[model samples]
Target: MNVILIGYMASGKSTIGRVLAEKLNHHFIDLDDYIEKKEQISIGNIFKSKGEIYFRKLEKKYLKAILENENHVVLSLGGGTPCYGDNMNLILNDANSISIYLKTSIAALVSRLKNEKSKRPLIAHIETDDLLAEFIGKHLFERSQYYNLAETKIVTDGKAGTEIVEELMATLL
Candidate 1:
């Protein structure tokens, strides 16, 4: 079985995926890290060199390859994975996979992102409160439709990591 976690940036997909995989005795894969390792370049660098269109094509190919594995695993997808291509459909078609969406408030996301703004290329340029708000709002609006297609949705606003994990465990089990 494969448990896939999907959500926007700062939604705790990677952290929760690691814990969940450990608990379930399954392999854990973070899609971004996988891409970086396979392509031998940072995602930021990929975007800089080849542009988002090329990076997204690579993301789809990698996602397809990973989905072919039969072993039980927990996969954490990139924030924008489902927003482009047929990635969401590919995930949904996997009978052994269960998709979970971590729903977080814009306020909570903004607060969490502030701490790691330097690391995120997409939001790095967002400086003022107004700009950040607008940036998040626009991106969220674009991504929410894809995120909503997940098999299960859990709100993580203000919740501790373990708390969210527990909720996910309950739902999955």
Candidate 2:
């Protein structure tokens, strides 16, 4: 089975997925990292060089490839992965996959993301906390529809990585 983790940016998908994969004895694949390795460029660079349209296309292609070919894997998707193309449907339609949304509040996301904006291409230009918060609020509201379709939802606010992992393990069982 493949466990797909989806959520807004800074929602701990990759962090929790690594531990979850260790416990489940599954391979952990961060889709962004997978794309970087395949494209030989950072996701940030991908956006800068090829543009978001191109990046999203690559995301959709690689996402389909991974879902179709991988097994016993914990895959963490990019923030906008499900919002583009038919990616959510592809994930939902897969019989061997379990989709989990690591839901995080906008305030929590703002706090977590403020320090790491440079690492994220989408919000790197957001200069102020108020603007960052506003962006997150609007973006989360927009993306919630796609994210909520996940087979499982786990709230990650005020939770440690291990606690989230434990909750995911229990949910998986």
Candidate 3:
């Protein structure tokens, strides 16, 4: 089965996916990292040069390719992957695939992002709490529809990695 992790940024999709894959003995693929590896450029650079539309096109292509592979994997998708294209439909059509949404509170997300702002190209310019909240609010509003399509939803608010993983395993098993 292909386990797809979808949620807002800093929701621990990649981190939890890595641990989940290890425990389940499945291959773990972070879609963003996969794209970076394939294109040999950072996502920030992609947005800076080719623009978001181009990056989304590439992301859709990569997602299709990865989903077609037969190997069992835990794929952590980018925040807006399902919201943009036919990606959500493709994921829904796969019988062996299970989508898991890591739901985190806006406050928690803001806190996490504040600390890691420098690493995130999209939100790097957001310097204040008000601006950060506004940015996340808008993005979350736009993406929630796609996120709710997940087969299972896990609330990750104030939870540790092991705790969340255990909950996810229980749900999947």
Candidate 4:
């Protein structure tokens, strides 16, 4: 079986996925990182060079490849992965996988993302916390429909990494 972690940026999918995979003795694959490795280019650069439409197509292709061909894996998807095309349906229809959404509040996202804006291409230009929060609020509103389709939802505010992982383990087990 495979475990797919879905959430907005700074929601700890990749970080928590690595630990969850280790605990489950499964391979960990961050979809964005996998794409970067496979394409030999960063996702940011992919967006810059080929644009979001092209990048989303690549994302859907690679996501389908991973979901169809892999097992015993913990996959962390990009923030918008499920929101595009038929990706959420694809994920949901995969018989061997379970999807979890790490639901974080906009305030928490703002706090976590404020310092890391430089690292995220989407919000890199957001000048203030207020603007960042506004952007996140709007984005999350739009994306929540896709995110909520996950089989499980975990509210992550004020939770330590271990705490969240433990909760996840309990749910999975």
lDDT of 1 by residue, 1-173 (tens): 89999999988999999999998889999999999999999998998899999999999999899999656989999999988989999999988899999998888888888878778878888887667877888999999999999999999987889999899999988
Give lDDT per model, in order: 0.91, 0.96, 0.93, 0.97
Q: What is the TM-score of each candidate against the true structure?
A: 0.96, 0.98, 0.97, 0.98
Tens digit per residue, CA lDDT, model 2, 44-111: 99999989999999999999999889999999999999999899999999999999999999999999
List ranges where model 3 is wrong by over 4 Å: none
Candidate 4 or 1, higher TM-score: 4
Q: How close is each model in CA RMSD to the real structure?
A: 1.0, 0.6, 0.9, 0.6
Instruction: For candidate 4, report its TM-score.
Output: 0.98
Clashes of each: 0, 0, 0, 0
lDDT of 2: 0.96
State the displacement of the C-alpha of residue 109, model 2, in Å, after optimal TM-score superposition: 0.6
Among the numbered candidates, top lDDT falls to: 4
lDDT of 3 by residue, 73-172 (tens): 9999999898988999989888879999999989999988888887888898888987998999999998999999998999999889999999999998
Candidate 2 — which pairs collide? none
> Where does model 1 exceed 4 Å of error?
none
Model 1: lDDT equals: 0.91
